[model samples]
Target: MVVLVQKLLGHFVRSEAYCLVNGKDLPRLDINSPAIWKASVEVGADTEAAMSNWEPAEKRAFRLGARNFYLKATGYLLARLPFQNMTLRSLRCLSPNAREEESSGSELRCLDMKLPQVIQPGDISMLMDEYTVFQLDTLESAENIDECWRAAFDLKKCDGTTKYPILSKLVKAVLIIPHGNADVERGFSENRRLLQDRARLTLESFNGIRHVVCYGERFDSDPSSFTVTPEVLKVVRNSKKRYSERLALQKEQSAKRPREEPEAVPNSEGQDLQKEVETAKKMLTNAELLIAHGLKTNDLAEVESGNSLLASGKSRLEMAIQKMAGSKNSLPANDLSVHF
Candidate 1:
């Protein structure tokens, strides 16, 4: 039974391409082959019918079909399945030809005309341990019929390691490509400019801006006539209402608070009074000292004038006094002797 199954599986795996090209259904190899036919009959009419429809050529076709089906199914299933106990060694047993093709890829060159190179088992194992192990394992095991397969596998593994799971899933499931938030942020920037322009716009006009900015699609026949939606207007109105309410609350609270007159600070009267008293005391002491010394007001005036003397004018004053004395001498000794 195992031998038959193995033979069937082998035939299907080998002729997958032929089956797809011909668009023929798979034929049952075990149906007519007495050993498996009895088991098919025991299973039911559907099984029997399926088995009876089997032709040897169709069997080949079915094997081919099965191979094609397995290729796609395994690729998808492996995407979700765990990769425990999975390695190049186990994968080699499942797909010997795939292993050989990967290892001996000198014939198949890349776009750069360089021979395809295989990654080291250690590297592959490390990648598996770090990222989506099952995905990498499946990809490594899957037949590399095209460059896209390797590219997709490598991208998935790399993305899994670098990005958060939710983001990675979004990349795979939604965009089907890895992209940063920069794209979304750019959309927001463009939308904001359109929505908050100097020219007043309705909600519909804003929606138009959003669509054009985010999706890069024109909304109306006349692009100028594009507009936003009611939903956007509702959001804007709610935000404005909330802001106004907050402002009103602040104003009310301010109004409710008690008003108080500003208090006046005293001038420096104490310092002024002290300074005046000291000036009075100094004048009285000066008067008493003048009386005690019998120094007249004229003497006091002379002392004040002397205190006002300039160093530069002192020589000129001395010269003027000498000149006066010389003029008196010039009057003659006889006129001077007559004077008292």
Candidate 2:
């Protein structure tokens, strides 16, 4: 246990920290407090020696760190005190603005609603006094504050309940503070995105763009669906000074785009292809007749059909003229042939 104590004190003898209570002289912290433990261990050497002669800046930093530590340790409880007190005052139609109670230190700061223009001054002195007594009584006697608040909130603001107006105003002020900052931050971000890198934007032009982007954000998935109306264009033209002949010019350009063009057709090459098709048709007919003649051997009726075709006075070989009337020297080395 002595070795453990020595080990911890070895660390704590560094920081300058002690305790204060009841406005009395400072007291050295318990060894359980790490700051004092380390200071004690390192004393009479670097730690305690430095405390005997603290530089101005070092002293400032030490005090600041101590203040921060004190705040962290006790701030949550202190913060709740005012909030609870204000809520209690609000619950009984007693305004926090009505009080000017002497307050000192950061922890006990009270509301300063002195300007009549700010709170619209009124006389609710009796209500304030009654509220204090009621709150004090409730603190001692009421069980389950959550239920008490619910009952208080349920109190209707009829002709008899004079407290409701004051309570409602207080509730509005208290409830909106935390949420209000988020709205302010959102507005700041919107301004940043709008105003950055936009050197040409005057206040008037910026107002127009603000309206455009806000209303047009709904069409963000397909921004082309958002047509600039005449009014919108007018605003831009009035700001930009180019509104007159452009609308007519834009309409003319838009109208000319959808006119149909004449389809392209090649007259010369098309005629040659047409002639080739007709020649292929004639050859195919002659070839079909020759094939049908070969089929006649199996069917005599087909042969009769062939004989009728042959009566056209054009024998199949005569159509080809394969035996050119010339000697072997006159014959061409290659002959025309069709591949399957």
Model 2 scores a C-alpha lDDT of 0.41
For model 2, residues 250-330, the per-residue Cα lDDT tens digits are 789989898778666645543433433334334435434544644643332223323333332233323333333322322
Cα lDDT tens digits for candidate 1, 130-161: 33432333334435433423344354445466
TM-score, cand. 2 vs. native = 0.26
**Superposed model 2: Cα runs more than 4 Å off:** 1-109, 112-118, 123-130, 133-151, 156-164, 179-184, 191-340
The Cα RMSD of model 2 versus the native structure comes to 36.6
TM-score, per-candidate, Cα-based:
0.19, 0.26
> Model 1: runs farther than 4 Å from truth?
1-173, 176-178, 181-223, 260-340
List per-candidate RMSD values in Å: 43.8, 36.6
- The true-versus-predicted C-alpha distance at residue 219 of model 1, in Å, is 5.2
lDDT of 2 at 318: 39
